[model samples]
Target: MDLIDFSAIATEHATRLKAIDPLLPPPGELPDDQGVLTAEASGSAALGVLSCEKTPADAPGAQWRALVEHRLDLRLAGPDPGTALGLLLEKWQERLAESGTERGDWETAAVVIRPSRDSTGSGELLRHGFAPVRVVAVRPAERHGRGPRRTPGVAVRTATRKDVGNVVELLLELQHYDAQFGVATVRESTERALTAEVEEVLAKDEPLLWIAEVYGKALGVARVQLPPASDWSKIYVDQSGRPKLGYLTSLNVAEQARGTGVGTALAEHAHQVFDTEGVDLALLHHALANPRSTPFWYAQGYRPLWTYWYRRPAVR
Candidate 1:
């Protein structure tokens, strides 16, 4: 393997990912249309390829992610995939050190892998200090069995501008809980950003924001995007062509409301609205290690599509 055979690489990678999880997106015509640092395994039974790319800090969702991200994609065939991965990472780090750009506490080295896959290269990733941080989970538009029953005394309704304060409060609570898991960073700007986000949604003609209330007290909130708004998330789904995509961007329940069905009411209400509007799928991101959300989401019919594994500061 003197030269990289990208065509052969794409087929193997796509086949493996699909086999691991049917929801994994189909591989592009090429490994990646954009240029990246490519490394191939040598003196190994497995043929492994790792392509590394940097996502600048200013990109969308950068606030939650680190200042800059060095994201890698791995493709492997043959036995000993872990050894090949180790070699690829070694080469990648060598190139990074040679580049001489500072690797600090603000940068991240990340990989998005399917969680359902075998443990072929996971140990190597962990040795490199990568931790599973986030998951892109999705629920179909069709109902599975009976939907959640409306919680007693909880009135789910569209949120108005007057409800912005309560919305921000609940959203912050959600972020703070996630921060403990290292997936969320509650910066000084988080509250301001969340407030602006809530206000913007409320201003929409038909906002997809909903609040679950008990005796006029807002105990839960669900922010979602329909159709054109959710098209950005369609990238995570397989290339089945765009069906009407809906995103469950944010969901939170107050501490006092947990296990009382407030979260379920809000979630099922969003699904009802999405289904009524003819959405094909509903997508959301949750911290993989968050015990509460992991099981909560699974019980709601959402399954993991992609898992983002990352090492902070882009180094050990």
Candidate 2:
């Protein structure tokens, strides 16, 4: 159908969704040139699904070798949009099968949706072979003017260019650990890519890098972006112009220091900083299956906002 009709369906969906969860961000405007598949079930308000693909090169971590992603942006409307969702997924699955995959063996089909919609569409997602892999979690900025809790001997400080080597080492440690859960991959160029990104952040006039140290030894890191710096992430978790957003880019604690409160201290420090800077909300993405991080973040007051469902290899 035309873009006008598609947008109307999406608008209707958004109207109903707000009543369900006011924090859920409105979907971004549909791309002018992308084609959308529409499904109209017997008693539904019609569902529109936009198909988009991302080559590894489109993102920094592309050099990681084993990552290819295909996405479906669903505009789900009506009282029972799940039925239409099932139909659209079925057709999309067929489209993938007929395309004949020469896309190597490292591809995944993904869909990201609000966590509140789980009951409505999750069953259909699972039936179509998709499983939750990652989540975009959120936290509000609130500490009642109190400072971050202190970890006995640990000190948190801003990182500078001189600390590049240590920062990269700690981040690499994080990537390798996440790789075990298939959330990340370590490739020949991984270090090179990471170094460039880390250096760029450190070079920023107001770099949001923090290092946790205990007696002159660095044991943890928290990378964050505040205000204008975090604007880019709005495409992932748009707050509908309601609040200023802050992003927790990455947080890593040395394996040896995992349970020693270093990570908590780092997180609280970041939250305090965000609150001080007047950031209204904080967002981050983490692996759903990570035994350690999943629980750690929940304890830090972040809960899942968007769940990314995936079917790996992207083949029928």
Candidate 3:
């Protein structure tokens, strides 16, 4: 068949499936909307659709943005999905040549249905190298519900200005502990004194700091700007009318306190507040290289909602 309108093709397929709703924004708008992508080539089966998403770092006022990278999706009946994926690979190679973007890690994925209904064909394509780069990366789902269960003796409490020094110290300690994992060893960062802007956050009635403590010793500290007055908060809102969820801007538990459950306690407490306030979700993102934090959040049920992409010189 002639080249199909690729841009609107996913939307059309989603519409045919009835999987998409009229109220929800068009395809690629929702954080988790997944569908199929098919090439226009005749004798080509539809390539599986990929759902792309990312979360945010638990830094004060930070927001998470989901990513959609459909350089190619081959999904159409009576055609070879593999052929379509191959075509996509070719197209991507072209992009790499034209744009100054370095090839990110080769990636590939299989189309998976939540319950495995009418999806035998899609699975097969993924098993084979339907696309170039061979989608082999396996990403964990974003965390949901409250968070990992509370760790005994680890109390998560809102921090006050008097606790600022202790909070900074814990953050520094936590960063240092991160060295074994190849992290550059945190500089015990964050300004020694709250900048004027940060001071305002502390002065506000709502909480500005979250600290995990035991016996009055702050083991870890995460900053937060409750009732986020930033664009990040607005993005968390269901611009499509989904319920609003409170934000978990940051969470940092000192090295000595990590496995002890300090981080979990802080997150759980945030979820509780969100639940009571009618907020629909609590979210954050960690750098891909930050292995320690990502697993910590996942065990708490935070699924990978989206991925934010960035590019810099490969050499430097």
Q: Give each model a TM-score.
A: 0.87, 0.86, 0.56
lDDT of each: 0.72, 0.75, 0.45
Angstrom error of the Cα, residue 61, model 2: value is 3.7
Candidate 2 contains a number of clashing pairs equal to 0
Q: Give me the displacement of residue 137 in model 1, in angstroms.
A: 0.7
What does candidate 2's lDDT look like per residue over 70-174, in tens digits? Answer: 667777766677887788888777777776644335545445455544457788888988878788888877623222345589999999999999899999998
The residue-by-residue lDDT of candidate 3 on 1-316, one tens digit each, is: 3335444445444453334223222334322223433443445534445443322233332112112122332333333444554454444345444544334422211212211122324433343333111111111123353445556667767777777567656644544544333312232222332233345556767664677787778787666433444235444222565535455655787666667677777766666665566565555545544666767766776654433222211111
The candidate with the higher lDDT, 1 or 2, is 2
Span of ten consecutive residues with least summed lDDT in model 1: 42-51
lDDT (10s digit) by residue, model 1, range 1-316: 3226666655666677778876567855443534444444443323333445554444435446665556565566544557777776676667655656466654555454544455667887787777778888888766452334556899999999999999999988988898877657777777887787788889988788998998888999998888777888878877565577789988889998887788888888888888898987788999989888888888888877778887766654
Q: Given candidate 3, what's the lDDT at residue 307?
A: 35
Regions of candidate 2 where Cα sits further than 4 Å from its true position: 1-8, 30-34, 56-59, 63-67, 115-118, 143-151, 236-242
